[model samples]
Target: MRKQILFLLALSLLCISFTFAQNNVQQRKIDSEFLNAVHYYENKDYDKALTGFDNVINNYPLNSKTTASYFFRIKILIGQKEFERAKDLTNYFIETYPSSRYIDEIRMLKVKLYVDDSEYFDALKEIAFLIDRTKSISYRIEAKTIGGQIAKSYLSSSDLLRLSNAFTGETVKPYLLLLLGKAFLKEGKKGDALNSFTRIIGSYPHSAEYFEAKSLIESPVSGEETSSGQALVGVLLPLKLNSAGEPTSNTAGEILDGIKYAVAKFNSGRTDKIGIVIRDTQNNEERIKQIRNEIGYNPNIKAIIGPIFSNEVRIAINDFDATGIPIISPTATDNDLTSESENFFQANPPLVIRGKIMAQYIFFVANKRLMAVLNSVDGYSPLLAATFVDEFSRLGGTIVTRQTYKSNSLSFAEQFANIAIADSVDGIYVPLAEKSDAPAILSQMVQDSMYVPLFGNQDWFFAKGFETSPELSNMLTFSSDFFIEFNSKDFQEFNNEFSNITGKDVNRNILYGYDTAKYLLTVMKNVDKNRTAIKTKMISGLTTRGYHNNISFDKHRMNRFLNIVRFKDGVFELIERFRSGSL
Candidate 1:
């Protein structure tokens, strides 16, 4: 009797253990499926993700994976723009998991759905409810932010009036007035728009829409006597740096002269003209701030042109962006600046793009499969070299060796000594733009008789006496966006006119200023004369043919073209031009 009882107990325990292990394995499989669905959602494979999420939901009943699958399914549906399906899933999630922690998130997503569909009234109603009730800080902020956007959209006066009546939130009112002003302007009711803008400016001076309203009131579209019927643009330059900083007055003068010439040329050709307001930033942060504030209220300045140093640009971009004023930087090439603000547009292409341009030329045009890089430690040089390295390797080209020197280093011996001039190295890339370092590297190469074709960036041509160096003159090629051929008839004529006015030879700064001003003026003519419309239009993928290159903008607002130039008999000759969107 005892043995029989023991056997029965043993059999029951074994069955229980086996059942537990099997359940564990099944749970793990469901968890894995849920994770895979998440991965698919992240990778933007909406269809597969939906199938995977549905599988988890059906197979993992009342489990954590099932709850997560429900939330993400709704999110994916929303991403795919299946609004009705998302609405259904959301309702199902609320009914199925009444105690889920993601309720706020789901509600926020619903608010986004309404806003995206331009159901502004519905969005506002939901946002007002969220702001009043939700304790989740992030959720409340998201709801209020969307409320602001809804107020900014182009809406009928009736719709605007309805929104105002529905939601009297302090944060949402200013943006509504802003949109109202723009709508009034769109109807050619400048007086009504001005009245609306004035009310906002007077009542809500610290509101988010205040800067834009002030801008519109100050620089309206009508060619009225107050606005002088012209596009008033501002130019901020570091014309006079401190004594410690190099005095680049001549460069600033040339740039200014070019802008003046372009404006004069433009005005002479057309009845609609642009006027420029020049401000010297003095290369100081405080000065830039002061000037920006002054320009911010100046009623006459519609757009801004410069503040060339990266540091100064960083200071001014946010202010200009808030005011709906477009500021174009001609020479600041820091790639990080592109993300600083929307209104900050770079007229010079970034160094990384230049590096790719060099790589493409060496790979396809020069047919050099193996290359070596000589680099310098500077803000700009290493980026150029690394970009070239990445691109060259991607093109099936080999980087035989890379060497670097400290900035302002006089000797290239140590940097160059380790580079073995292999037979495979068909070219050498010199990624320094300075006058001394580039020529020093080239001279060392010449002494060793390693006559490889040397490649350089735009700064290589900026050196004054580079052409006089016999070792540096031949097999030397660099890239730039500005190259004026004296023999070209049109250039010759422009040169004469520019010389007559400025008594100075036109240089790179001049070319950039001319190009930037001309481009802005052309855009001004096409876009609405109001500040908001002009600002939006400038960022809307506008492109134009400039003097030496085609000026188009990338999504980040960086100039999109680079011209590869070769040095021959003291002149930099344009060998090839590369556009970012093209090969």
Candidate 2:
């Protein structure tokens, strides 16, 4: 009986060992499949990779590969743009594999996905969670980078409270300091911003932020080495002395009047001041070259303005390379010039800046849901349309349609009809240069039963035919830099002075010219006629209490304040004023 019992025990042991061996083989197979899935996923063949991972999960439910498989499957879902599904899978992975090494990476990816989908608040929540949960240095750096970007976006519109809240602790202190400086700069608080930047320079000397901080603070003010008395101001303009098919020279004449007025005012009380020199390019390339050659030899010419056409501006930039003379265009609205020339500045707001402001006004101020952009054939029109699209989309708004039309084309009924068929867009933005075209566009839209609100640039108010077109008058909203309706007495007094000097009514462009002169004079009073110093003053958001607006400059030297106007009963009225911080 003892021998029989020993044989049975031995057989049972052998059977148990065999079953264990089979289980090991199966687990190895699942592990191999899971690794293969990861390889395919890295190769971007997400469909097959997902299938393989699913097979691993189904075949080896309790194996070591299970957690890894869940993690990788979440990645594949994200790659496929299946965000909602990927979010659910990520939650599952976090719950089931709480000890997984990739938890922080998964959380970062979730933040990125939310950002990509325009779910900013949700992304902020994930960032908060990651900051609260993780001690990993890499993850903390990532959180700071993302948080800084979001804070900068809010700061663009002058939302400082949100920006301040974004950086809370010592871990993100450096980035917060830099961002606070930028925010203060946006709100026209130069002293504060400068202080913040100076702090970074002093405290974080070894960091990369210190390098950028130093570069910014040093570049703009360096040009002030030359004195105003020693420097010559170059004015490049198309004088339009003889041009066919042009209006009664009212616009150019008014511009020149404003320039002369500024110069006269500056020369009135000052002794040994900088002299203003004018160069008329006549909108010709050869003339521009001659003018550039003349200015190139004269060291007295420290700055320039005008060359109103976009092509002319390009020529001027190429001809004046490394001259260190800043060119401020009084009327040019082209966007490409600024990108090409660091020395270039636009006294009139660029189309892109105006477009961005218009988008913000419509989406945030007016609370409009859907926006449609109607673009003209003018070169600036496309840029305006594109900027509106980009800024609106960035702010979590949808663009209903982008319509393009040839200048002087009368029949827009078909285009209006098609736009009307699109889901009800609450606002429409038409950037047309010619007033004659405004009535036709508005008439077609109104005839098509499209009563949605319309928005446009200041040009709409100056358009000639808009006065008689009731439909256009009723549906129009526009933006301008200056308006006569400001309740401030200082503005009224300035308007009176401007009218007396120029003999023209006060408008946005006039205000721009006056402010431009005021700004130049202000710089002249404080700094020598050095282009660098003037640029620094311009970029530093120097405060100017002007007739049109409380003006300041951004990093790119674009004006930060815009007045929102609406046309009612045949006149443009200032409906609201928009500044950086006031939303």
CA lDDT scores, all candidates in order: 0.74, 0.70
Candidate 2: C-alpha RMSD to true structure equals: 19.1
Listed per model in order, the count of residue pairs whose N, CA or C atoms clash below 3 Å is 1, 4
Any runs in candidate 1 off by more than 4 Å, and if so which? 1-232, 238-253, 275-302, 407-418, 462-472, 501-505, 525-550, 581-583
RMSD (CA, angstroms), candidate 1: 11.3
Off by over 4 Å in 2: 1-225, 228-232, 238-254, 267-272, 280-301, 375-382, 402-424, 433-437, 444-449, 462-472, 480-513, 543-552, 560-563, 576-583
What tens-digit string does per-residue lDDT give for candidate 2 at 1-583? 9999999999999999999999988878887898898888889888989999899888665777777777788878887889999988877776776677788888888888888888766675566667656778658756856765676564342344354466554434445566667667556676777777798777767543564455445432222243523555676767666566332445555565566677778778777566677766777876776565456434456677666667888888766755667776666767667778887776656667888888888888889878887889775777778877888898889998888898888799767866877767988888776667876886676567677788888777667555455665666787876655656676677668877765766765555565666666666565755667777777776756555655666567666677788777766677766654321
Query: What does each candidate score in C-alpha RMSD?
Result: 11.3, 19.1
lDDT of 2 at 379: 53
Which candidate should be chosen as best, given TM-score against the real structure?
A: 1
* Candidate 1 TM-score over all chains jointly: 0.57
TM per candidate comes to 0.57, 0.51
